[model samples]
Target: MSVIGQAEGIEHGTVRGYKQHRYRQIPACDACKKALRDDRAAARRGERPERAKPQRTSRRKAAEELDAATEATPVLLPVPPPPQLPDRPEIGVPIEGADLEIGDVIVFLGNHHRIDRFEPYTGSLRAELGEGTRVACAGTWGMTVGPTSTVRILPRPRRDAR
Candidate 1:
């Protein structure tokens, strides 16, 4: 059987060699019949459905161009200052290791302090004649090692580093 006829036969159920039956001739509505015929004709003519067009882009090339455009331009950024420790002393405040030692006269940035006594086993220190309580420093303190040999602490020692 021809393809178009077979297709039409499937839609309307009218086979060429089959005996007539009440169901075979059940008339199809005009619109349905015409649509099936059009589809079959289109299939025979080999007409393809239209496809969506592809998009074009030069983003990467544009970015490279931009980079090249700015390649010769110089950029300036600010540098950050170094971290600093606080001056003076307080009680119940633990300092790592100890930056000060007993007998060390430290001029804190804002005030002056001298560690007259420091006990490593108990992590306690006496500074400023005990005015500064439990002073914290960064290294271990030992006897005979005085402030003259180590860094000093002075609160607001100079106009800078305040």
Candidate 2:
């Protein structure tokens, strides 16, 4: 029997005690199914389906245009050099035996710090340094400052430095 359709005038058959319907009803091949799907899709889209066109661009033309634009633009002025940083003042504070008060500025290990609070009982001083400042000493938080710690008093920043 033909696998694709009913053989001759035969509409159905029985094989192994099982009834076999026509190919259209019982089974359709891959090609038939794909064609039916494409027809339906085209009907829904209201047009014959066509393959997509490849998108293409000319790299050489684009590069030439960019080069032309770069050449056409004029350089009006040379860029100025960056301004120099003002000289910092020399200030020091020896944590070992130095009197400290709130709002006092000191430099520690080349970084500037301001004493924000002092605990007489614990002999701990809380100081705030410039944001992003890095220091080598540890325990700068609570009970951190010790007599052995030497801090330099930072010079006031020039008005321009602000």
Candidate 3:
């Protein structure tokens, strides 16, 4: 039966209208009704009871339990093995002037920033990879196949020529 927007901030007219329209309206909580009944009973007896205090748990025991739980579980994961490069000499050799295409898995040999990721060349040429990420090429190079051969580059999609 609690309302809003009146002298007590409850909409009195709306409450009255709702009560008139509905046969069984204005639903109230059981605990609130029980509290009202208890108040009435206490008033009739002319006795008021003090509120009950909450129980406290040991902080040291709680801390010990939390520490035991944290110790039981592992926080860090196991590190994985590094990526492997192709064994062939021709494909493994770094080309002086040749820019890597999409699908070309090149092992970085230069000492600049020193990371061991296989640089897969795509048609787009622009690699949207984060810095310092290491990758390995799965395909091996044959004597007949060059760096841009279908055997080595056919696994991934290539960008359309402009």
Task: Give residue 43's lDDT in candidate 2 (0 to 100).
Answer: 61
Q: Per-residue alpha-carbon lDDT of model 1 for 25-131, expressed as tens digits?
A: 22233344345447558858876343444546499987886688688576443333233333223311111123454544444343445566654333344342243
How far in Å is the alpha carbon of 51 misplaced in model 2? 88
Candidate 1's TM-score: 0.18
TM-score: model 2 vs. ground truth: 0.23
User: lDDT tens digits, residues 94-162, model 3?
Assistant: 321123333454443321121222544333333333222223333442112223222221111224423
* Model 3: lDDT to the true structure: 0.35
Candidate number of the best lDDT: 2
Worst 10 residues of 3 by lDDT: 149-158
- Where does model 2 exceed 4 Å of error? 1-96, 120-143, 146-149, 155-162
Off by over 4 Å in 3: 1-25, 48-162
Q: Give candidate 2's error at residue 105 in angstroms.
A: 1.2
Q: What is the lDDT of residue 66 in candidate 1?
A: 69
Compute each candidate's TM-score over C-alphas. 0.18, 0.23, 0.16
lDDT of each: 0.38, 0.41, 0.35
